[model samples]
Target chain A: MTIDDGPASDRVRLRRGANNGVYERQAVLDVLDAGLIAHVGVATDDGPIVIPMAYGRSDDSLYLHGSVANAALRAADGTDVCVTVTVIDGLIIGRSPFHNSMQYRSVVVRGRARRLQDDAERVDALRRVSNHVVATWDQARPPTADELRRTMVIAVPLLEMSAKVRTGGPVDEPEDLDGRHWGGSVPITSTFGDAVPSPDLRPGVGVPSSVAALDGTAVHGLTTRP
Target chain B: MTIDDGPASDRVRLRRGANNGVYERQAVLDVLDAGLIAHVGVATDDGPIVIPMAYGRSDDSLYLHGSVANAALRAADGTDVCVTVTVIDGLIIGRSPFHNSMQYRSVVVRGRARRLQDDAERVDALRRVSNHVVATWDQARPPTADELRRTMVIAVPLLEMSAKVRTGGPVDEPEDLDGRHWGGSVPITSTFGDAVPSPDLRPGVGVPSSVAALDGTAVHGLTTRP
Candidate 1:
């Protein structure tokens, strides 16, 4: 396997199955936008740790916030970190177990993380993060100044990134394509159930459009549109 | 946030919302068994990198594959690595943006990785990895000696691991629970579609049992049971 360049970037090191490398910026963005959580890798004195963190995407940045895992980000500030998000599509079952694979879309973003200290940017990023998960900014109470301080928001530019996608039927070895074994892809699907309302909801409160309009692709980013 | 002991080891570094920590070994094992892919973190000369790879869970070990991404794993051989797998349940919506989060179950296993060299173990691990994704070993053509030799497999002990879980309704601030904002959990659903037969599938080969049974929760592991 040799290194194949993607998007003329220094960070992308795709090899082996270079055909799976996706170079389109829009394609990479689509995966990032649809993904719910990103696995963040940051190095520390203890060793390298990869953490699953919920992220919000802007046009050029990814806001990662999961207050509980803030320690990893805190250490990642000004240091290179790898953020990977993947959407599994299905299982690729070939004529042989050796040829079986998975259909997935993955994006790896690498860059130095910057901690957000400014209140306005922090609030905006937080709002995007909130809406990214399930839009609740408009009706929900806004974050107080104290809450903002308590929360930690880290931003990573989406400039250095790469995308890989696997689709279609399995690629079987010539000798094994005898048609005796069953081969095809079994699609993995996620069906959203009805919303479970809070026990002490206000009398007139109804499900928000964001909660109502989850099409399984992802939560619509329109509600928080500027 | 403070460090709490989970199953007695020097690893678990959980902080902030310590109640989220689930210290039981069985709970950790359950997450590993259910997950299909894991984001593996390995420290390389380039820096810390996280690669999402398909993994199969054996009692005390995990076999990581995704042959294309084997480069990262090869560099991690005999080195400390962190493996993190996550299963997202729903979006935890609070009355305020600051309190919003996602309901998830995640396990973090940390330890050195050893590349499997023995053919017997390699074939065994590969079969487990295949079954873990979708059971297809029974009817599918078996891997040849050459194919097995061409493949790469690595194993990591399930030691120094931690599990974190977030469930239930949002933890709303007393002041903001006025029922003004609609808040609850929107479950994320995955539904598997019918098997898409390969373009050149053998006419009489019916779908395998593994392909027939996909419950969204996961592909059942009974077929691969010894």
Candidate 2:
């Protein structure tokens, strides 16, 4: 696995639109920390499989957890996997349909995933993954002993990874610049809607500060927060 | 490859939360047609790689187009690939952080992707991919012969596919139901913002009717639309 501060290997290298690929460590981490959901891929006897799962980043490793019965975890345990997170920032509408594209920031991490067998490691990884979603683990009830036993957490170190970003407006063809066509981007913002309180909540238990902070926040990216 | 009506192969089968897997053809197609972006995964020499890109659905096959120079297209051509599309509906806030999860609809399609070399087939597939984003290709300039030659379109049949969806609120444990924690869903909505017309647009060329129609449309799942 190629570490930070060097060019990526052929496998993780960007062959097309190389400019969009961000290789610096800080840039790659920014993309990873921003996204809550990651699409993890693993090879199987039949073929490769990809599925969306929640994850948390701790230092140089990304942690993913599920029940012991989860098929993705079972297949990915001690095996190579690819974890990808994509945040669609906007839609690129071009003068010609051929040139139309998406404005997005995506991070791809390729490495071996090892299912954490240590009890303490599993608990900490679960907390990390949970914190990314709610951000108020101290207020919420921590996982019980039995709950930890039923869960499976796997970690993929940030060894071979690259970040690809596309921003700004559409790049129309030279000839089409004068054509009668509208070309620009329609920004897509993902924000938390009105919070619906749980019916079973005890009286006076309003939305927690951690959950309330999500309001109007960008769905992906820690940097977007004020 | 497992056909539409039959049960999915074990490779594509759901084991963790089996009940979330939807095997019916119509249900799976609905999820695929809803999104413009798909995270595609393919095995490589170093490991599996996943990247997000645009896609189009025509009948039983899913089409993905990119430049001939694109690395993903080159690797996926004539090889098995996993195309996963996920639409996040809301964040499930549970009584205990352990039970907290996401409400999302995801479709996973696995099969060998073949690069369309036939000129006519390539042109049609490109149109399908483009139309999914803007929806009105007739008004936009069609790809010229030279543009067609420069693009590579790969088609993955929806033979081995399944849709896994989780909706409604979180189901907390009986003991935690009495806990003092705020819990409910924070709905997530993706809609197009105000259209920013291209600076090069000719006068009187306002936002097209097709683009305007996307003003309040949901990012994924066709059923969410009016």
Best by DockQ: 1
Q: What fnat does each of the candidate structures reach?
A: 0.84, 0.82
Instruction: Report how far off residue B71 is in candidate 1 (Å).
Output: 1.6
- Candidate 2 residue-wise lDDT, B28-127, digit = tens: 8788877758999888776788889998878879999898888877988888899999989889888777788898888999889998888988878877
**lDDT for A217 (candidate 2):** 65
Tens digit of lDDT per residue, candidate 1, span A74-151? 899889899999888888889988778888888889887998888889888888877665667886877787787778
RMSD of each: 3.4, 3.3
Error of 2 at A133 (Å): 3.1
User: In order, what lDDT does every prediction score?
Assistant: 0.78, 0.80
lDDT of 2 at A72: 72
Task: Give a tens-digit lDDT track for model 1, residues B28-60.
Answer: 777777676899999987778898888887888
